[model samples]
Every structure is written in C-alpha cells, then in structure tokens.
Target chain A: MTVLINSETRVVVQGITGREGSFHTKTMLNYGTKIVAGVTPGKGGSIVEGVPVYDSVKEALRRHPEIDTSIVFVPARYASEAVYEAIEAGLNLVVIITEGIPVHESMKFTRYAKLNNTVIVGPNCPGVISPGESKVGIMPGQVFSKGRVGIVSRSGTLTYEIAYAMTKAGIGQSTSIGIGGDPVLGTTFIDALEMFREDDGTDAVVLIGEIGGDMEERAARYIIEERYEKPVVAYIAGRTAPPGKRMGHAGAIISMGVGDAASKIKMLREAGVDVAELPSQIPGLLKKVLKK
Target chain B: MKLYEYEARNLFREQGIPVPEFRVVSTAEEALKAAEEIGGRLVVKAQVLVAGRGKAGGVKLAENPEEAYRYAKQMLGSEIKGELVKKVLISKAVDIDRELYLSIIVDRSIGAPVILSSPEGGVDIEELARSKPEKILKIFVDPVVGIREYHAREAARFLDLDEQTLKKAQQIVIDLYKVFEKYSCELAEINPLALTPEGSLVAIDAKIILDDNALYKYPEFSGEYVRDLSYYEAEAKKMNFSYVELDGNIGILCNGAGLTMATMDSVYILGGKPANFLDIGGGARADLVERAVSLLLKHPRTEVLFINILGGITRCDEVARGIVEAIKKTGVAKKMVVRLKGTNEEEGRRILEENGIYVLEEMDEAARKAVQLGGAI
Candidate 1:
C-alpha cells in the first residue's frame, strides 16, 4: 500500500477552473485518481472533466464529504486563503502545486496546520504521487512505476529526473513526495523519512536534497541514530552555486552559512548513508546497497 | 528581508509597543539637531540590514549634540556587510537597569510560530543556543488562535520577572505578536528590552525580516535596484540569469545542475579555476547565452573564453549562435574554446566552425587550453 495516498483517497481540486488546475486535473484523472469535486470561488456549478464544482472548500466538502485530500492549483497570491479554507474544512492531507507563494503565507498556514492535524505537501512543489494509486501534482505520469523506493526532495524538476533515472535503472518507486523549494516549509526531511520508515512497502529511500538549510544534516543524524533496516541513498543538488549567491529556490540561500552541498554530502557519508555525487549516480549507489 | 533597528522600532511604535523615541537621519546636522531637541544622551546606529553591527563599529553612543555629529559623520558613508551606510538612527538613550531578549519566529516542523524569550539579552541567540540553551523558553502558539494571553503569561513567568514587570512584558509580547502577523515578517526580534531606571520596559534594539517572497504585495520591491552594473551585466540580470564577474579567462556555460557542476570541477581539475559557472538551463535561447557571454567578457580577468553546451532539451546550435553573436558584438580578440555535445552536436559544431571559432571536442582539452591561455591574464 502507498503511504500517503491510495485509491480510497477521495480528492478535491482547489482552483479547478484556472489554467494549471484544469491541466493537472486532466493529468490526475487520466492517472486514475478519483477527482471527486472541484473548488473555484466564482465558478461554482460549472463542470470540468464531469467533476462537480463548488464555490468554497466547505461547499465542495459538503458535496464530497468523504474527500480526505485536496490538490490545490491556485495562484501564488491566493494560495494561503485556499489552503486555510481546506485545513479548516478538516481535510487530512493537502498538496499545493503553486509556485512563488509568499513565505509568510506558508509560515502562517503551516503554523495553522500544525495546531490542527493537517498535513501539507508543498506551496512551491510538484506535489506527491503514489504510483498506481493516486497522482497529486505535476510529476510526469509515464516515467513512474510502482515499487519499494520512497522518494522525497526539495526540487521540482530533480524529483522527476531522479524518478526517471531510477525507472531507467529498473528501480520503481513506492511513493514520491516533493517537500518544496521554500526556505520554511510545512514538513522537513526527517518528517518524510519517518513516514518512509513506517511504511511497510518501502524497501529503501532516495532523499533528494539541495544546498540550503540544516535539513540534510538533521536527516543524517536521524539515520545514524535510528539505524533503519532499509538503506538510504542521498543526492544533493546545487553544488555549483556561487559562494554567496541565492539560487532560484528561497531555501537555496548559502550566504554566510547554512546550505552548502559539500558539507551535506560529508555528513551523509559519515552517517553511513550511501551518497551519490551526481544525480546519474543515484541508481548505481542504490543497487550497490541492494547487493550488500 | 531583514529591516534595520530603526525600521523595526518604527514598526513597533506604530503597533503601540514601548520603544525609545527615535528619528532616522542621513546627515550629521540632522543627527545633531535630533539629539539637541531630545536634550539627552543619544545612541547613533548605522542603518544597514546586518547583524552584529554594534561590534562592527557601526553603533556609537553620543553623550552630547556635538558628539552625535561626529558619530553620524563617521558612520554615514561607511560600509557594513557590503551595504553602504546611507542613514543613521539617533535615538534618545534609555536608562538601563536590566535587559531581556524576545522573539517570535515560524517553526517549520511544528508549523507554528514559536515565541522565544530569555533574560540574557544583547547577545547572539546562536551563542546562547550553544552555551545555555535551558535559559531560553519557547512557547509554540497556535496560528489559528494566535499568541494567547496564557502563553504570554507563561513566557513572562519563565523570564523570572516581578509581577509589575511581568504585566508589562505580557503586553509587549501581545503587541509584538500583532506586529509579526500584520507585517508578514518571518522573524521579529527585540534584544535588550531594557528595564529602565524608572521601572518601565523599552525596546532598545529591534530586527524584523520581512518575507522576501511576500514582497509581491509590496509594489516597491521591484523598483529598488541597489548596485550599479555595466550594460551587459545589467541585461543578464534583467533576464533572471546568474552571472558573476570573476578573475579568470575562461567563460564556461553548460545546463542542468549535475552537468554544470561537473564542468566547473573539470575545469578546476585541469589546473584552471573556471571564470564563471553558467547554467543556461533547459530551453536555452541564443539571446540568453549571448548576454551571458557579453557579461563574462566584461570581466577584467578574462583573457580566454570556454563555452561548453550540453543540449538536453536546449538545442546545441542555439548555444553556438549565442557565442558567435557575442564575438560579433564584443569585437574583442580573446582566445575561445568551444565544446558542444548532445541533441544537435554536429550542427552546433558546424555553426561554431563556420564562424571561425575552433571547437574542442573533448572537455579536458578545452579546459587545458583555456587555463593555459588564461594563466597569462
């Protein structure tokens, strides 16, 4: 069984009338996700892909009360309000695919979600996809095949790249989660790693990290101390960022300190986790662990 | 998105938080006039968005109006953390009996705003975290309910303040929470909130980091351009491209995270530190690469240029045309080494060769030549 999502996970599409919402809704539906209802404030009662549309999250929830997860496609400006509404509606899991959302909005929403027991995947990410069960965000549907490797990352495109590389190397994924590219996000690497550890189907884990935050180091400590049965493979992006420049992702700031790639790789190596210097080397590293 | 002490205090004052009376001034005359009108000792702080400015000789305590002039004169044109000091905050100094630290920041894992307080103020919190972590009390506030009165009381009690001081501290915390929420700040901190000789609390220092991504709501965000760059350097920045003027001869360009990094490392391995790491990522257009080359050529250290294009989704010929265009525009007779591979490698190589720019097929050979030529720079 997939860890975060499955066939039983009824979903609602927030901002379903917008261009991105409409496009990804089609993708999710084609991938066999149950698209229960859609929410767009002004465009209620309209139908997209034969799915029901409602004005607010409450209205959509009223129509499809069984919906446990929400896939949001709202623009950056309105992402917080949309997320807040879904959380207040008691949706257990929310996947936000909108890029460029304000950090303060995510911080506030994340804080609110924590007080409540809602789990948010991203505000500037590709969202999570449990192959063969439910695909949430913008991951290419073709490259993924269901297997035992649990994948999590701070990058949008790199997740797709790693997943593709894994598939090409004859490795399939159990679940893939994009933690997003924001400096302050709802969940950390450890949080996702814990979930992977608990999931019985996940045989190993592939952690895709970037140059920012102490998250990779924190995850390394967890791996060292916990001594998980499954092997963990790590690949960090942004090794070429200038000494003091901030990259595209807000979390990719490597100013005076915090978020250097070499230091993160060193920590992972010391922790006994197999670390790949390049993205292409991940599959080979994972296979070596399997042989051992 | 960090604000200076004066700016944070201004925000706090607007929110009805108790702070020393202050005026932000640019000129020495303005600073002296403010100090004279206040009729007391003043603190002159350099206006720069950096921490530890007090230790950097940016903060000065002026005992008289004439001293204020001297301090402001010294600080106004100075540089702190790469930011020029264009302004100074002249504030009426408070009589300090004791000092405490307070802050509220977003805790990502918990998804809550944690209000942190400690009696040990006017020091770097990181140092405190490393040495005496137990002295700091953290209260995780529910964002839905916000910073409650009970939470404020708990923090005050933990700070070990007297009943009257606790009340004042409680009110300040409540006001600070409001300021944090309203300003869209990621972090709002007040260090050395001094208990005055008169037994009232005054925020002696404040720091507010406004969330940079949230600046879309603030129209002034885009218009504020600080540094001056040359024509090509400006154009590269305008297109959201990363360009660094470096002390080397080779101009290296590649795409993707792993590819670009490997290219740079290869250049270094071949006994040449790359002039710049340019990733003309997916869908690389000729114009973007042209601008990239133009920016690279502007560097005084560049005696030779190396253009490495690996076309995954980006066409190799596009990268070649950009190098050719840059050669035509700059008119500089700099030595160049070209490496093109992937999608349309043959066609891309033909474009470079037709334009009289010799193409080096191997990565190592390109690096060796570029480094050997650049060493003369």
Candidate 2:
C-alpha cells in the first residue's frame, strides 16, 4: 500500500563494496528492505550481509529478475555512470544516495531516466522510506511509523527531525522521501506530490522545502492548478539566510532576489497550504488539516 | 565557480569565438603600456566577481593612454560590490553597429541546457526577462541531441539577423554551446555580442560559471580564481565543511545542510540570530566534529554555541565526543546548548551530561535555551 516501495519491492545495491555503501547496506537490511542483490565492479562473486554481489547491474538482474529497484551509493565521480548502468539494465526505480554529483551529469542522466520510463529519487539525497513495511533509504528507521501522512522533502536529517516529532505526537507516516538538495534533482516536489496523491495509504502530505531555485514556486502553481485534494502542510527552512550565500546545500541559495523564503512562503500560503513557522509546529498544523 | 571576465574571454578566444583584443594588468603603469600599444579608444574594466561593476564605477572608457592610467589607478585596489579589484583589463573599444545577447545556461526547470538571446543587449537579462519577457528568445536544447544547426538558426532568426549575419550568428551560437558543453559551465554568456561596422560579430564580454561539482574534471582551475571567503569560511572549505558566516551571536552547527539551515531558522524564529551556518556533513567522525566545533569557538562573534545533531548517517556519540573535546581544547567557556537524538543517543547524552553540557531532546527547546543563554533578544 506504500507509494514507491513496500515488502514486495526487491532491490539491488550499486557500489555495495565501498565504505558508505557497505555500511548502509547493512542498515537497510536491518530495516527489512528486501535487498536481493549487490553490484560492485571487480568485487563480484562476494557477499555483503548475506546478499549476493554481482560485477554489474546486468549480471545482478540476470540472477535476480525479481529485482525492480536499485539504490545507488557510488561516489560522485562514478555515481552518474552507476545510474546510467541501472537505467540501461531496466531498473524501474533508482534511488541515488551519493552527494556532490556534477549537475551536468545529473541533467543528462535524469533526462535519460525519464525517456527510459524510470524514476530517479536523488543524486545527493537520503533515499526513501515507506515505514514499518520496508525502508530503502539511509534515514533513521526508528523515527518513522506506518500512518497516512506522506512526507517529501529536499533535506535529510531535517526530515528525520520532523518525522521523529510527528511520531512522538502519534502521527505516523505512509512514506517519506528526500528528493535531494541539489540544484537539479531527479524527482522534484511536483513529482513526489503526484505520487503521494495517487497513493491510497497517504491521507495527507507534508512538504519540507528550503530556499533555492523555483521548485517550491512551481510546486505551488501545480497544487493550485490541479486543485490538489490532499490537505498539504509545509515547512520551509532558511528564512534568515542572507542573499548570495549558500546555506549548506548547493541549491539553497537566494540569488538575484529569486528563491527566497519570503517569496516561497507567500506562494505556498496562496496555494492554500498550511505553512509551519517552526519545524516543531508541523505536527500541530497537520493535526489541524487532518481534522478538517 | 565563477570565472573572471578576462578568464572567460580567454576561454572564448580558445574556442574560436571572436572576442575583443585585451590585456590583463594589475598595475596602472602596465595598463597604460597596454593601452598605448593598442593605440585606440579603450575600455578599462576592473576584474571582480561581483555584478553591476559598471554601475559601481569599476568600468570606465578612456580616450587616451593617460586617461586609461587614471582609470586603472582608480579601479585597482578599489572595492566594487564589496570585492577588491586586483586587476584591470584594457581592451580596444569597438565601433558597434548593433548589440545582441546570447548565452547557454542549465535551466533547472527544464532539466536541460537552454539558449537565451535578445536583440537588445548589454542590459540586465533578469530585469529584462521580468519587464519585457517577449524580448528574450529561449530555446531548450536536449543534452542528448545537443545544440543542433536548427536550434542555432532558430536563435538567429529570432534575433532578426540579415542574410550574411545569419550564418555568422548561427555559427557563434553553436560554438558557444560547444564551449559550454566542453567546460561543463553552469552559465556561459556573452552579454553584448556586438556586430561591428565591418559586419563582424564579436563577443564584447564573456561570463562563465563552472559547476563546482564538475571542478574535479578541470584541475587546472585550482586556486586560480578568487573566492569571496572570510577567514573561518575559507578554513571550513579546506576541511570540506559547508560553512557560511553570518552577522549573529549564536554559533550553529549541525549534520545535514537542511538540518543546519533548519537549526538556524529555528534560532531566528525564537528571536535569536546565528553567527554562522556550519554543516559537518554526513558520517563525520569525532575528530572532524571536534575541528568544526573549534572553528566556531574561535569566531569572535560566537557568544553561544548551539549544537543540533539529528543522527541518521552521523552518529550522536561521535558528535558529543567532538563537542566535549573542542570545549576542553579551546577553553573559551561560552554558553552551550546541545541537542542529541538518534543513533546511540543515550551514550551521546551521557557524555555531554558528564562534561556538564546538558542535552535537550527537542530542537526547538535547545534553540530557545541557546538564545536565552546568549541574551540575544
């Protein structure tokens, strides 16, 4: 009943022999993510956490044809190639957890993924989690519980912070996705919103956006134009950030007076979305919207 | 990384795109010699990374070598848009029959490279796009297909080019796309693509911003460009930490970029200003966290240190150990508020508690405590 993944979603791990890849592979396994195979060039024929490792995605697919999803943990320089490999092998959904990927490479691969009818979650993101059933990302699994509220954000630990608060307040989540903090992302706020809209398990949505680019503005336009049915609660970070300064994320900059918190907040509020002033206020806002 | 105008000009010239003849000089005497050698009406331009250099009096037209020297003297070492002008470019001023605008930039909305052109050039493109949207011609180019001849021809037609100028302008557009692709630039622009009296198309100015993520492919650019970095900011860059200095009292440090920014925003919402935004990044060990904490403690404006760690990949215990080590090493004795949750939270809380640093479970509570302790309204 989850949006993108569930107990039946078999997975393959790309770059599973590396430090982050190996570490998170174990953690994802611990979260019951049904990881069927691992792919690492030259490190094939090995095993990581009782999962079979293949030299390439094609090889992994041949042995495990049930694997329909892939999670990439490759380094930035080679991450794009790994994504291309996953797409070429016909993986329906690829979740990229690598950070610092070149935007140009991401642009080409994301377009390629689209043409091939594949979905990409992030290049510099913390994957995805559907709570209780299965978790495909590197997020803290303990913070999330199965519920009807779907969470999508452009942040990592920040999503966890809010999700943890919601869980403590007896507000569980159906799925949570970090769409990444890069200037160019594979899955944007609009894309995630469409997915959440169609999911029967998700009764409400919480969008976590920050300053940078016009994605938030565009999402607001989409929400209004489509007359979105779900009661959406939102929280945008970096309200006090200065102009022309990158607030940690490469995409989180207020440039040329565009993509500031004030403008984003204004646009979202106009779209009839309840915007939280603080991260702690999100649970209360969701409760208000759910009540209505 | 944004390249200097002179550097962009050099790249354009290398790619066979025509640009005005120029010499980059740091001294006024060198500028005078270069101007005399060119022997025509020249433009003296201060080399800075900031926008609106012309409005800041950093760009001046000189009638003779003496005037060029005076302009260079006035511009060199002068501040423009808060950036010091360390070099001046003396170039021959062209007799322009018409001015045009052309650029290839990665459009985030389309998720592809886009070509933007306007017949009315040498003006603010953003302002123009806002006020007169119809004046700008946008052509989206697929990265897979690249800049086709038809795309260039379409741009040339949009600009109302003549029969002779059409071919030349189209070629220049295609060449500019090649440079953009080759260099992995976020933006490669020729602000005023001038058509001279001789019917020659020349790039009057060049602006290129290379993707920071793609810098690894171009190692020759290392340490060549000047970044507007403060002392602590530069230090953070060396350690591979994302840090931005702000004018506030509470020093904010956290794990992820969004979390760090959220921490800063939380402090702001509670009426506290953050001194700096520092993200130690994911999976940071104890030593790296110690270094980040020390960097914040050394800042003069940091009166209270707010450490918020929502551990996912980053371990809470490691962060707590680093904070404890930093305080002991620096001995600054500033007011501190620590929030540690997730991934060995009990151990991290115990370590902080043993060091007299009580930890809060909630981020808002921690931010409020730090703001109150710092006495920052």
Candidate 3:
C-alpha cells in the first residue's frame, strides 16, 4: 500500500562499485530492498555484494528484466548521464543520491524523465524508504517502522531526525522520502503529496520542508486547490535564517525576500495543515489529526 | 555566484547583446581617463555584488570627466549594501525613450528556464513583481528546446514594442538567453533594458549569477566571483564544509545541511542564538571533523559548540574522535554539547565520554543543554 516503493519493487544500483553505491547497496539490501542488479559501466561482470554488475543500465535490464527502479550513487559530474541512462532504459523510478549536480543538467534530465513517463526522485536526496518493507535510500533503517503516515522531506539527516522522533513517539510511517535539497528537483512536495493522497495505506502525511524555494508554498496551494482530504502535518526548518544566505543546502536560502520560513508556515497554516514549530511536535500533531 | 555589473556587461557585450560602452576602473584617475575617452555623459557605478546598489548611492551620473572622477572617488572604497566598492564601472550613458526589464532564470518550480519581461524596469522591479505580478510576462522555455525565435518575439511584443524596435528587442532577448545558457547562469538579468531615442535597444544594466556547481566549466570565473566570504566561511570552504556565519553565540555543527539548519532553528526557538551554520557533510572522517571543531572553537562569537550528528553515511565514532582530537590539538577549553546518534552511536559516545565529554542522544536535549550552558536562559 506504500507509494513509490514496496517490498516487491525490484531495484538496480547505479554506480554500484563506487564507495557510496557499494555501501548503500549493502545497507538497502540489509533492509530487505529487492536490489536485483548493479550498474558500474567498466565494472561489468563484476558482482558487488552478491548483486550482478553490468556496464550499462540496458545490459542490467536485459539480465534482470524485473528491475523496475534504480538508485544512483554516481559522482556529481556523471550523475546526470547515469540518470539519463536509467530513464532511457525505461526504468519506472530513478533515485539520485549524488549531490552537487549542475542545475542545468538536472533541469534537462528531469524534463526528459517527465516526457518519458519516468519518475526521478532526487539529484541530491536520501532516496525513498517504505519503513520495514523496503529502504532504497541511505537513511538509517532503525529510525523508521511501517505505519500509515506518509513522510516527504527536502533533507537527509533532518528527515532521519524527524522520523526517529516520530518512531520514538510510537508513530510509524508508510514511507519517508527525501525529495532532495537541490534548487531544481525531479520530485517535489506536490508530486509526493499526490502519490500519498492516492495511497490507501497513508491516512495522513508529514511534510518536512526548509527555506529556499517556493515549493512549500506551491504545495500548500495545490492542497487547497485540490481540496485534499488527508490530514497533513508539516515542519519547516530555517526560521532564523537571514536573507540571501545559503543555509548549507544549495536550495536552502531566503533569497530576494521570498521563500522564507515565515511565509511557508503561513501558507501551510492557511491550507489547514497542522504545521509544527518543532520537529518533536510532529508526532503529537499527527496523532491529533489521525484521531479525527 | 553573482558577477559584478561590469563583468556581466562584458559577457553581454561578448554575446552580441548591445550594452552601453563601459570601462572597469579601480582608481578615480583611471575612471576620469576612461570617461574622457568615452566623451559623453556617463554613469559611474560601484562594482559590488549586493543588490539595490543604485538605492544605496553606489551609482551616480556624471556630466563630465571631472564629475566622473569625483563620483568614482566617492564610490571606490565606499560601502554599498555592506559591500566595499573596490571597482567602478564608467559607462557612456544612453538617451532612454523607455525602460524595460528582461531576465532569464532557472525557475525551480517548473524545472526549466523562464524568461521574465516587463515594461516596468528599475530598482523597483521586485516591488512591482510583489505588488502586481501580472505586469510581468513569464515565458517558460524548455531546456531541451531552448529559446526559440518566437519566445523572443513574444517577450518583445509583451513590452508593446513597435515592429522595428520589436525585432531589435527580440534579438536582444535571444542573445541574452544565449549568454544565460552559455554561462550556466542561475539568473541573467538586464534591468532597465533601455530603448534609446533613436529606437535602438541597449542593456543599461547586467546581472548574471552563475551556478556554483557548474563553475568548473568556467574556471576563469570560479575564483573571481565568490562574493565576499568571511574569514571563517572562507576557511570552511577550503575544508569543504558548508558554513554560513550568523550573529549568535552557540556554534552549531552537524552532518547535513537540513539538520544543521534545523539545529539552528531549534536553538533560536529555545531562546538560544546560533553563531553559525556548519554542515560537515556526509561521510566526514575524524580529521575533517577535527578541523571543523577547531574552526568553530576559533570563532570569537562561539561561546559554546553544539554538535548534532545523526549519522547515516557519516560515522558517529569518526565525529566523536574528531571532537576529541580537536580539543587535544587546540587546547581551547570551550563547552561542547555533542549529540551522536545512528551508526556506531555507542562507540562514538564512548569515545567522547572517555575524553570527559558527556553525549546526549536526543537532538532537542543536546540543543537545550548547549543553550543552557551558553547562558541563553
């Protein structure tokens, strides 16, 4: 019932022989993600952590036709090419874990993915995890447990932090996705909200956002426009951030007097979302909404 | 990174977009000589990266070379929007019949490049956008398709230009897009794109913000346009950490950008002020963490350091070891509240506790402790 991924979802690891790729492949595999094949170009015929590696995504697809998704841990320079390879191979989903890809490349590839009917999750994201069922990202497995609350965020460790807090409060999640902290992303809060709204297992959603773009405001508008029925709890970081200063993440900035936390919080509240001032308040807000 | 107006103007001129003839000079004497060469009423502009330069009195129109010298003397070494004006751009002033706005920006929401054009153009463009968004014409250009002839024509027509002027304006739009694409600019702006009395279009001002990630392709600009980094910030950049200085006391350090920002927000909310935002980035080893700790401890505003690490790819023990190593190396006895969780939490905690530093598992608890110890109560 989880959105994007589930236990049966077949996965291919792009850049599988690389340090991050190899490490996360084992981690995802340990979390019971159905990682069927790996792609590392020159490292074809090599096996990484018991998974067969292929030179190309096409070759890997030929060997494991059951592969439906890809998690890319390629370096930033080659990350876009890897994404295009996955998209052209007709993989349904491609999650990019690589950070620092050029915005132009991401814009082009994301558009290409859209036209090709493929879902591109992140260029600088922590991938997706369906709690106990599957973990495709680099998030710690212990912090998340299977439940009905769908979580989507724009951060990595922050997502883990909030998820851990929720887990500590005995509130498990249906799926937690880090949509990435890049300025241009393939999947946004609105896109994840749409998927969450359709998922029968997700009774509510927790949106984790930060300063930077107008994505949060846009998501709030989408919710109101669609008259979305699900009770959504939200948390936005960077309330104290100054204007024009990039707060670590490339996309996390209050620039040109727009995309501040105050405006985002206001918009989300106007959409009837229970926006928590602190990450720890999320579980309590979710409990209150789900109870209704 | 934001390019100086003169630098942006150079790029625009190189791309065949007509800009007022200009000379970039550092000295007032150089500016006078340049103004004499131009032989016309000129605008002397301070070359600062900050916005609203004109409003900050960083720009002045001079009637003659003597006035240009006076203006340049007044501007150079002067502060505009908190940025020191080290360079001045002396340009031949154009006779403007009308002013318009044009820019190509990577619109993140649509995931594509967008051209925004308006008949209204100036320092007040942002105000115009906020008050009357409809006044601006937005044309979303697909990155694959790029800026076509029609896209430019559409923009020119939006500004209600006459047939001949439309053709020239359209060409400018197309050329500007080329500059934007060629340079991998986040924003390529020609504010106050002036229509001269004789109907020729001239870019009065140029603003191009190149994407920092794509700077490798343009190595010339990589070192030049880093927009004034503070001492600590520059140090952090050298160490490959994301750092932003803030006006606070508690030095906040974490593994991820979002987590660092969240930690800062939490500290602020809990009556504590964060000194800076520092993300050691994922998979940071002990040496990097050690350097980061030393850097934070060196900050004068950092009374206490709050280190929150929710390790996924980043190992906890590595961070803990770095903290211990930093303390030993620097011998700066600053109070530190360390929160080490996720991978190898027990080992990390043990490493810190062995060095007489107690660790908190909960982020909120650690933040509270740092705030309390920092005397934010």
Ranking by DockQ: 3, 2, 1
Candidate 2, residues B248-333: lDDT per residue as tens digits?
Answer: 89999999999999999989888888999999989899999999999988999999999999988888999999999998898878
DockQ of 2: 0.83
TM-score for all predictions?
0.81, 0.98, 0.98
Model 1 chain A lDDT-worst window of ten: A240-249
lDDT of 1 by residue, B251-281 (tens): 6666543345555555665677666655554
Q: Give me the displacement of residue A35 in model 2, in angstroms.
A: 0.9
| Candidate 1, residue A116: how far the Cα is off, in Å | 6.1
lDDT of each: 0.78, 0.91, 0.91
Q: Write the per-residue lDDT of candidate 2 for residues A1-292, one digit (tens) a residue.
A: 6888998999999999999888999999999899999999999999998999999999999989999999999989889999999999998899999888988889999999999999999978898999988888899899998899999999999999999999999999999999999988889999999999999899999999999888999999999999999999999999899998888887888876688998999999999999998898999999999998
Candidate 1 structure quality by residue, lDDT tens digits, A1-292: 6778987889999999997788778979999999999999999999998888999989888877798999888888888889999999999999987867876677678878877899988877778889999888776666678898999988765566567778878998999998887777777888899999899989889998878777898899888888867789988766656655545566666643557888998999898888775566788998998788
Candidate 2's TM-score: 0.98
* Candidate 3 chain B lDDT trough over 10 residues, lowest sum: B219-228
The docking category that best describes candidate 2 is high
